[model samples]
Target chain A: MKVTAATFTNLSPEWILLGVVTLLMLIVAFSKDKKQYLAVTVAAIALGFSAMCAFYHMNETNQVMFMGQYLITPLTSFLKFLTCLLMLAGLLYGRDFITSRNMQPGEYAILILFSTLGMLALISSNSLIVFYVALELLSLPLYAMVAMERNSGRASEAAMKYFVMGALASGFILYGISMLYGATGSLNLNEIAQQLQTTAVSHRVIFIFGAVFVVAGLAFKLGVAPFHMWAPDVYHGAPNPVAAIIASGPKVAAFAFFLRFLLDGHNGLVHQWHDLLIVMSVLSIVLGNVIAVVQTNVKRMLAYSSIAHMGFVFLALLADNPIGYRAAMFYVVTYVVMSMGAFALLTLVSKAGAEAETLNDLKGLNERNPWLALMMLLLMFSMAGVPPTVGFFAKLGVLNALVHANMTTLAVVAVLFAVVGAYYYLRVIRTMYFESASNHKPICLNWDERALISINGLMVLYLGIFPAGLMSLCQQFVG
Target chain B: MIQQVIFYLFAALLIFSGVRVVASRNPVHSALFLVLAFVAAAPLWIMAGAEFLGLVLVFVYVGAVMTLFLFVVMMLNLDEVPRSKGFVRYLPFGLIIVGLIVTLMLNVIDPSHFSLHVNAGMIVPQHHSNTKELGLMLFTQYLLPFELAGALLIVAIISAIGLAFRGPRARKVQDPSAQIAVKRNERVRLVNMEAEKKS
Candidate 1:
């Protein structure tokens, strides 16, 4: 809370995003409906600068700011940088989709910017209150973004479902936080950890009770099974671009939130929360993979796949070592990249005449737009964890962490479920390549978008081959 | 002893009104019971030395928010709607869950488990002000969350407008600019005297 020079300097990225949000608001106010498209480019540039600012301040790590309410660490800076970049990519992928659908691109961009600001704050949050506020700031925009398609009754219903579930999750977290505060008389994560280390056995029971609720709430936000009821419905019902945004940066931010809550705040009680995570992870892998195979809608399929992927992240987290955390970080980063690329391709295929939602919409995509189909093939292959893609390495890293922790049984079960998960992703590829084209029109994209998709697709391959650099960086930061 | 008696009286009243707020069949009655519950609870805070919180809760929540709730409930005419019939079917499960939760809470909050760090009989000094202490903490140590909550409100406003706002309506709206641009002569015309013969 002190008005120090370091505080402003450290928080430059958030200030930049907040400034961009205000600027977008003014632009939306002044400009006519059609002219508000300019806000997208403005927001993209602001996000680029924000990411650059985060990278520039990467070395100023481990500095607890605002009376230990906020943190600036190398890991947080890296996650923030990734979140901004992913949001920028998501915005680009969504640009044509929003404008074509007559959804206000200006408002869409503003909400994305606000959500990104919230993610940045969530990544840096060091205390329970900041975490809760940042989480709400992150979620409120998403609910509106999902409901932005005002003409669609389905989207409205999806928004309602998301709002109710999100409210319940927030309530759980709040109630747990209140209990934790009562038990420890502190809000700062490190202070809570310190208190827990010395607290009596009787106090530990209340702390564990609070931690159970908190873990359940975090699992809900992460969309792991048993708490993942809203993901598929929201994904299928929301507009494509909003789904893309939901699938990307927010996952990374949610991982950071998990780390702050469990690793930072309640590390002393790992043996207790560890059991809860095990049940959630096993259920997520089992249910997400099993149910995803039957999905006809591509969005719902991706939603289920995301649940399975988060299960792998939780597996890495279960190892409870630096290597395990690094693997979890790597897995989340890889998942975000693949999910963003896949959804962006979905946005591209969806034309004006018909919303390309079902698997049949993607039938024989190879014949109509081979390049776009190739990009999608790469993304799907990556998602399925084929040998040449980053997804394989990400899964491998998680398994490695699990084996290192001597949880070979869980590792084997994960591998089994992953094999089941691969069937659906390959089914997407099979529909694109093996099936006959029904919608004969070719999907035309601007050169820049095509190139962006190309880079997104190739990054999966390139990172798979050269993951040593990012892997080492993850290791270094987690250390 | 008098303070103890007052505490138990209002505490009982608070719990009773709280239950009635949920159990009342009439929505207006429920809202009124809620207001009473808020009123009953404010005294507890004041008695606990949080005078500012107690007064503000009464003023802001009871006076403004509960009154607004009452107006909305009355306007909605919810009493005309029939209640759901499945409550009896669900009551057993609900009671079981509630019982379990109460037991767990009682176990965790058992007074014997806690070694009190603060002396229970400590008295407040003359002219002590918890309001000032609360303000100082809010503006100093807790400022990050305070400001973040402000930002959250902005997001709430944006989402509210984004979801609810439609474009300009075709219905007639006031033209404030045109209203202000009217000249004196335009608004009121001077005319020559034209007296009618009917007078």
Candidate 2:
């Protein structure tokens, strides 16, 4: 509980990350205006150094520090490490996009790093206060980044819309937290859980209402159906590189928050929340997929697809077992990789002034650049949960967990929705292969962007074909 | 007692000002009414012995935030926004929603229907002052959160700068720094010229 040397050692990842943030600012301040290339180098090393620190601490056993403010375990450490890798991939894919748009590279890289730090803090937080602040830390920079393309009216509109809705959601969460505090008189999750055990039935109802508010707020952040109204607009409006980070980075962190809050804090009332999650899960999958089928804008379609994908992740949590947790972890990790791959290709194909986003943009892509088209096909296949891809294994893992928990009917319903979802992903593939572009010019991609996409695609296939090792590894953490 | 009467006065005025805040046609009036509502609510907090919170509500929110609200409201072209219409037509639906919410609030708050006994009346603790106790706890156990709040402020400032402040765009005057880039060979050319005749 004291501020000892062990506390410093245990939180070295965060400390190193903080140092990198300061170092980044100094580098930006000292550098010339034309030396924007250094931003990528600084960011890469910052992410690498922090990831190394996290990886170094990966084998550590669970330890509660800062008087239970942060609870670092092997799982949180491992997820932080993976998130750093994902951000690194995002940066690589986005490097050319940033260069073309003349985005302030220092600003872009630092926001990404700060958001990553927020996620790491969120992952390790054991108290609601810590989690909430970390959530704000993650979102504040993102709002600004979403509006970074200054010339576009749509970008500013998206930013304003996101900021307002996000504030409302945070209000809901704070109200819920206040109500929960009134009921239990504790902000610490463990203490709340303990107090909840002896609470009367009437107080339990109050707690349930509080928990509902909390879930609704979180559902907004995760971009589930009904609360997912902002996602399509934001994704379609923001610059491609920023949109990629929005889709990948925050999603993984949101899933981490879900695990921590539901499993750790509200696990005592799992029965109450299980039905709530099911309703949201079913609604998200059904609505997200059904609406996605009609979308012509590629980015908007992917946004809806993300909603459905989130629904599947929620299904794993529906069972609330160790196996279910592992399955959810695997699903989220793979989904991030697959989405990153698709968006990277989208970024690569676009020029600065003309963003390539519509279905027409992909027409005859196969003829223009066969390799790029193939990668897009693979990414689409993975998203559609087709065979020999990570997406298939991810869905299969969650469904298997559902079946194990005796939810066959839910599993069947999910599979039906997955079939519906496949239609949209296949629509993308069909556009790429079956049609020819009216205004055709081949995409010129830098080697870095191309190599990043290739590695991302290969990762998806490799994880799909040999998923057992990672699956069991996830199981080892949650089990 | 006089305390009960005063409490009722604050509550009644708060409700009145709160309604006017939403119903006022002029945004400037609405902002003023909002400040009034906040002022009314603060007295109730003071009556509960939370003097620090009550005073903070007045100073931080009513004094500063409401003034900012007025400035923002006035910054917009007020002539562009037409006065709202259809108040009577929408009244029935609004009433229904209000009725539903009142019922829901009553359902949860009715302690007599359940054994749950929330404090319906104010009680002042005798051992310590309100602000003193809060300061003690905030400085000790909640120190990290207090620091994190400062961090949130920093984020807000940075975001505001990033999103809103693009420095000095669309200069009507020629930039001297840009003019400095002109070279003699680029800006001027020397040529053999024919002498003009007097015409």
Candidate 3:
């Protein structure tokens, strides 16, 4: 408990992230020049440093930092690495859009770094209090980010809706945690589980209610049906890069936390929660895919698509097996790649005057830019679960895990909904290739944008074809 | 005895201010009353043995956020609170919900089922400090959830930024065609005038 330089050294990664974020904030505050690239450079360097720290910590076995609230475990390290990479990509995509719109890049970068730090903390949190604090920390900044486009009414509406729903979800989660604490006289997940195991099932109704409420709150975060009302509006209203981060980073972290809390801590209650999850999974798959088919706005379509993907991931969770956990992780990774790629392509295709939100904007995209069109094709195909793309394998992994767990009916429903999802994804492809180019000139792509697009597109193919190693790693983690 | 006195005092203040917050006619006054409620609630949190939460509530809600709320309310000029017919219709439902909650609490805390004793096992000793024990338990046992909270905070931050930076479509005044078509000559015109001698 003694404060010393050595103790600080033990928390060097966290310090490093905080320090960089602080630096970015200062730069944003002091620098009058809007064209300053220092913030971007600092953000990139910080991301790289975090990645390195994560890599270093990956092999470290169960080292608790920050007086036990934070941990440096392989799971935390892996998630931190993935989140940092996604943040970096998001930052790159954000740069041109932010700058073009006269936004303060320094503040934007700093907030992103701080948010990323919060996410890392959340992923490594050891207590309910720490978890809630981190959740709030991550959430408060996103409310601001969603409202960052200060003048847009839609943006304001999106921010308002997101805030209200998020607050309600937080309330639900807090109430659940409090009820759990009241029931078990403890907030620790391990202790709660132990207590539940010992206590008579009839006496644990409060705990069960708490667990249900907590899952309901998490479902809101996951954009599962009955609580997914805000996803489409928020996703469509926010900037594309922001939408991409919303779709991937938070969803992945939420799933990670869900697995940690539910699968690891409450595995005994699998029978209790499994049916509920199965129901949610089925509803999410059906509703998300069905609604997405009719969306004219590209962002809204992807938002629904993301919801469907969450359903797929939920299907994996329903399996309640190691195979299921690994499949879920794989699905998240693949989904992130495809979602980022698709959004990145949208950013590239959008001209300065026009926002690439509608499907009509993609008309004749292939005629203007073959490379982008091809990239879009790959992403759409991947999303549609076509072969030779990562999405195909991602879905296959989830289905296989579900089948292994004797959830064949859920797997069938998933595949059926996936077919429904394919229609919308392919609609974009058709627009990109089959239609004639509009009279307007195609948007020019910057080098960073092109690089991201290509890498994201290629990753889908690479993972689909050579997924053995990654699958094994996931399996190891799932174990 | 002192702890009980402080708890009751803060609890009373919290309830009074919370009522005022909802019932105040002016939005600004309502926001101010909410701040008072939050401040009072912070002490109640401390009484509940959550020191961190108490401090956080004071710092975040009472100090910073409520100030922002006050500012926003002050800036927006509203003549009066909008009276809605829906409020009257929902009043019975609200009261019913409140009644149900009270009944539930009463059942849970029935004196016949459980008695409060000074030396009961459930009560902590006067000298016992919860913070240290809480810290230990949180770190040693509830580690993953603590980290997951951190990730949730990050997501919150991202969502906030997204909300703030949402583009203003209706108010935006950019015509790309006009901007792209403006020639250099049009932007930089050289006008020459002949000067005549005036007597």
Candidate 4:
């Protein structure tokens, strides 16, 4: 029961992140100076290094660290690696964006690092208490980042809504944990699963009560239907890079969160939760797509599309197999890449004064900047699941998983929603390519920014054509 | 019999204050009533032999969290928050939810679940201090999660600072880094006029 040095080694990734954030915080605090460049460089280098080190730790599997509350397995390592990768990309895109907006890059980078750390812990957590704490650590930064633009009234409003709703979700999760503890006398996920199997039939109802609350709390985090009221507003009101983080990295982490708590803990209660997920998935897909088609704001539209995307990912959960989980992992990784590119482009194109909030902003994009236009076209095409792009394969992979699980009707409905979802993405492309410019000024980006965006965009196409590398990588660890 | 009397005493007041937390018209009153409910409920836990939980609940919830609730409630624009326009309309749904929860609890929770027939868990002597035992387990067995919870607080601090911090504006400011990075030749004259001032 003694804490040992090996415990630190097993938790190397988390320790490195902690060290980086603390160093950044101290440097920022001591100097009455804003060294935006130093902070960003330090964060980028540290995250990049930590992400590379994550591969070494992957060799250790099923080993518990810190009294069985933290586990090191291939799945945890892989998810952590992907999360770190997405976060590094986000920070790279955010650096110039944060500095240009007159926000302190040090605080911004610190919050992002802390949030990533939260997600890392969340994915590897083995206890309900650890999971809740990690979930908060993951979320607290987001609330602040959403309203990081303090001078903006709309940002403040969105921050309030997000905080209140997020706090409520946390409360629900806490209540569920307490209820489960009351029923099973255990907080460890594996122990809870074991205890549930032997629990009397009468007590299973109490377990179900807790299960429902936990599901609702998690659903709120995922921003799926009936619990998605906060997503679009937060996305639209937040700074573009912050919204990009919200939209991409935490989502995959949320899936890992779901998988751990459900499959690892409450697999005994499948009959209790299966139907609830089905309803949530269907509503999310239908409503997310339908609402998106009407949104004129590019960010809001993408927010809705992200919800629908989650609905598809939820289908993988319903499939309840290793292949399905791998498919989900692949789908999520691709979606994250494509979404990050789209939002980073949004960040780049928005002039310091006005935001790219509406469809009209894309008008004459081709005439103004052809390369930017091409990037948007490919990113949008990937989002729409067009062939030769990874989005199609991602969608196809998930659909095949569904069919293999004998979910024909759900698969058919999902395809219908996908078609509906495509309309808005294509609308964005049409505005960019077909329309003429109202104001004749080029969308300007620096060489580095331009290069960064180009690489991200090209990767979408490259990965789509050569999906096996990522797919096999996902399969090696998942399930 | 003494335990029964104490249980009933706390339980009655707890329910009454709990009802007032929702029914009170003023938000401030509701928050205060919530504190009252917490204070009343702690004794019930103590009566049930959960001495550690009782004291901690009082110390943490009533002492810390409710005080915060009062501070925030009093700072708010109470007039802006409508008191009862939608109350009547929402009451039915709220009541139905309460009804369902009570019904479920009644149907599923057996009396035996609350009785003292359950065996003592793990290891604790007849006079074991619950707080000490908890500390031992938490610091040793659950150290990682315990540390994670600490990290969560650090995040909370940063988040509060990020969201709420606005630099003091319209005032002259100095950067220490800029000052420290300055060379002697930059601001100080080569003639060394500063040394001449002593004369």
Candidate 5:
């Protein structure tokens, strides 16, 4: 194929999303209104348009865009679709919070758009520079969003900690890239792989060092054990909607990038990094579950749960088999749904201008709003990997892949951790059902919040019952 | 010959500043010394033929970022930093670690190992240096990772902004939101304007 700049100019659905976001940002900045309904409407339209574009793109075959740097494969398209969907849900869930705070709705829309752009770039990135740029594009906006609640000292502290640790990780990643470039004299993944095939491993000491550093940098993003110190703080502090986006969308994108860079590009060095990943996964699973048990703060507990979930994803990555990759992708998709639903309920349950941080806040949720309680039940169950919910299928897929890869011990450990994880998730359910309301006020759900929560909750059940279609899509991409 | 002289001079300066950074009693002075060390090291990196790293080290670490660090250090009251007498207990372990690092560095340093001869005959004019080549490579081949680093920088910037802009309470200001949202029209208005004018 004779690649040309014109080939790169073909407007993908992501490009349409970028345009919509930019346009929405401009409108929000310029327009004045007592009610910022226009901003919300525009954001919804843009996200919807992006989702439609992703669907359109999915029908096409894998092809390189932007002169082979950006790829538009089915995998990228699907992940982008999922990211856009989650962003839309988050914006809807956050509408009340944004309005109550009197924050610039345009800024929120633009930041989300920028994050979407980053996620899109991350999924499609074939080159190292593009990948890093995408990662930043996604992350930087998130740091701002974390501190968007300007009056909250907790938010500021969380944003600061996340930012510093993130910077150190970036520095590590850059140093690794430099070392890799120095060793291979090339940056293209295929070219580097070809070069490494001929080069003796012992002769490429810099390459190994670079690989380790790069993986470490990626581990920081994945929030695996030892690199996950910031996750709980950030999650506990960030607004529920922002936390939802952080815990779900960017995480999935990061894992996609990890699969691309580590599993695909540096597949040869699997033996070198697999043990490290194993250690990280094991530690994340054990510590994440154990610590989460003691947390009264619901958000903090979920944050710990996320770390443990990431461990399972890392285990799949360590498996380095096609089934494992597929399972990981499926697991991530389900996780996004579960997290979005859970956080949506969190947003719905809280009163206007207040954050729902504690388990006590969820008390009497079942009596106040049974439907929302039901949604929360499904989400928690999904997260706990219970049967007839998407969470179970997600876990089953991962466990099956691990067992298939002859990782019985790791699978056993994962099963044990899953059992541990169930406790924290179920604690919320218990709080809602078994406990009485501390305050007798019925929780009100907004139209957008209701719609998002219902969809997220139902999707978990729908996917769990019939995971074949999503599994097939994942299998096709990996194949 | 000029390049070698510059490299050695900067290398010595870097080491001197690094030692000073560690030994300086004042935190502000230590920060300044660290900046000096970083600045000196950039020239050494340039001499090692890694122009990209050299320029970035100066531009990012020394010029903008380190200055900001120095400002923050200077702004802070360093009396809060713990001055423990228990440091003597850990001094031996620290020294052992340093000694091990020095031995490792010595073992790795072989003059013959770095003997990849540069093609001096093919040197480009200073006006047409390898900056363009570097930029092309950065944008094209390494585009993903390059962009990811840029995102990390944005993250850093956001973090810094968050840290610097402590809340109104921290800054000893009344809540701006409360003040801004107050309906001033209700509190003050012109009643009987003509009578007021006559008065």
Candidate 6:
């Protein structure tokens, strides 16, 4: 735990993000209107550097820093890399959408940088206190970002609802942590795990009681059903880019947060939390799929689909073994890529005074722009878990984990719900290809978004065909 | 016996203020009651030998935060909330839920399960400073959390400004660059004009 130059080197990713956030704040403060767009460039470059830093440290694992309250591991570093890519893509994809509407891109970029910092910190947090602080840091900016569309009443309402529910969730986590601390006399995850092993039955009950609240808070963050009341509204109401950011990076970070808190901290109480995850995942799969079919708004539909996707992650998580965790990690990374591509495409189709909010907005997209349309087709197919796409492999990995855990029935149910979820994603594809254009205007995208979206969309197929690389990487980290 | 008496006195006052905080009809009254609750609880903490926490709680919560709360309550121009008809309808269910919660809390906090010796007093080590110890820990063992909390505050400020700060759209602010970059001839036409009389 001694501080060293190597420790700083190991923590370069977090330090880079913190430095970038500070830089963005200063830019936002002094920059003129014409120069404000520079914030995006600055943030994107910083995110790229941070991501590179994370990738560089992939081999250096189990390096504890900040007095054992921060940890570095292969899995966390990889997650940090993914999160940085997510933020960078979100800014790149969101720029045109935000600028077209004359929103303050500077503020938007700074907020995203802060949120990225929050996510990185949350990913590496080893203590409950750090986790809670990082959670707030992640959330506060998102609430503002959701309300970025200042004129939209829907956006303001969504921001308010998100803020209130997020605060409640934070309260739940704090109370849960307090209870756990009371029971175990420690706030560090490793300490808590060790304490639980020797604690009495009464303390165990208290730990379980505290853990229920913690799981509930985590469910809210993950946007699983029974506590997913805010997702569809926030997604439907926020600007396209904001929703895309929320959907992509935060979910991955929340998954890491889950692993840190539950698996790392309270693994001793797996049986107690297993029942909770079972109920949540089942509800999320059924509800997310069944409700998504009726959603006319594309954002709301994606929201529901994302819920169902998280259900699959939880299914993998419930296996509670290395293979299960590895599958879960693979599933989350692929899902972030797919969803980010999907939302980026949505931003492309959106024009001034006419957002691509409905299915009809996507009608005849192939006639308008074949290349973008093809990318959308790939994303939608991947989302529906069609073959030759990453989503299929992701689902296959989760199901394999489930079956390996001898939960064949659960796997069967998961596949059934996935089929139900496929209906909506396929509906999107049908709207894009089979139907004719209503607007008849060609979809336009800048080179940056065009190239990024193409690469993102093709990744599904690329990883699907050669799943070994990412799969083995996940196994290496989790194992 | 005297310590027990003092503890019971403050505990009762704390519970009374706490109930009043919820039971008060006016928000201003409720805020005052909350302040009272904090005041009552501080002495209870002090009686338990955590005098530093008690003093800090009074100074921060009562002296500063509650005053800010009162200002907000007065400025918000909120109307009196009318009682809803559904309140009476839900009374039975609410009472049942309350009873269940109380029972659960009692089960969890059953003092009989704990081994407690009701000593006459808590022994405080000579020259032991709670504030100094807490400060040392905050700067050393707990520095990460302390720093992260500061970062969280900074995030809160940024979010508040980002969401609530209405800049050029709300007010006509001066551009210093434009002011400083002004060309003398362009800004003021130096055309020779005939001297006009007072008319």
> Which of the numbered candidates is closest to the native, going by highest lDDT?
1
Count of backbone collisions in candidate 6: 0
Give the Å shift of residue A62 in candidate 4. 2.7
**What's the lDDT of the predicted structure labeled candidate 1?**
0.88
Per-prediction TM-score, chain B alone: 0.78, 0.73, 0.66, 0.71, 0.65, 0.78
lDDT of 6 by residue, B1-199 (tens): 9988989999999999999888777888889999999999999898777899999899999999999999999899666656667988999999997899678767765553333541235466898999998898888777777876777788888877877776767568899999999999877887788879867
Name model 5 segments beyond 4 Å from true: A1-11, A352-354, B15-39, B45-127, B131-199
- TM-score, one value per model: 0.92, 0.90, 0.83, 0.90, 0.84, 0.91
Which candidate do you rate higher for lDDT, 1 or 2?
A: 1
lDDT of 1 at B139: 92
lDDT of 4 by residue, A42-78 (tens): 8888887778767777777678766677778888887
The parts of candidate 4 lying over 4 Å away from their true place are A200-202, A266-271, B59-84, B92-124, B169-199
lDDT tens per residue, model 2, B1-199? 9999999999999999999998787888888999999999999999877889999999999889999989999998365346558978998999997898678657664564334355445456677688888998777777666655665676676667656665447868878987998889987889988888866
Lowest lDDT sum, 10 consecutive residues, model 2 chain A, at A28-37
Q: Each prediction's DockQ?
A: 0.52, 0.43, 0.23, 0.51, 0.25, 0.49
TM-score of predicted chain A against the true chain A, for each candidate: 0.98, 0.96, 0.96, 0.96, 0.96, 0.98
Tell me the spans in candidate 2 whose CA falls farther than 4 Å from its real position: A26-30, B75-77, B83-104, B112-132, B168-195
Candidate 2, which CAPRI tier? acceptable
Taking every candidate in turn, the Cα RMSD to the unseen true structure, in Å, is 5.9, 3.7, 7.3, 6.1, 6.2, 4.2
User: Which pairs clash inside model 6?
Assistant: none
Off by over 4 Å in 3: A1-13, A66-68, B1-20, B23-25, B32-75, B84-199
lDDT of 6 by residue, A353-444 (tens): 48888998989989999999899989999989999998998999899889889999899999999999889899988998999987887877
What DockQ does candidate 6 score? 0.49
* Winner on DockQ (1 vs 3): 1
Give the per-residue lDDT digits (tens) of candidate 5, residues A199-233: 77664665776777788888888788889999999
Model 4 C-alpha lDDT per residue in residues B11-93, reported as the tens digit of each score: 99999999998887888888899999999999988776678999999999999999998899888847433575887899999
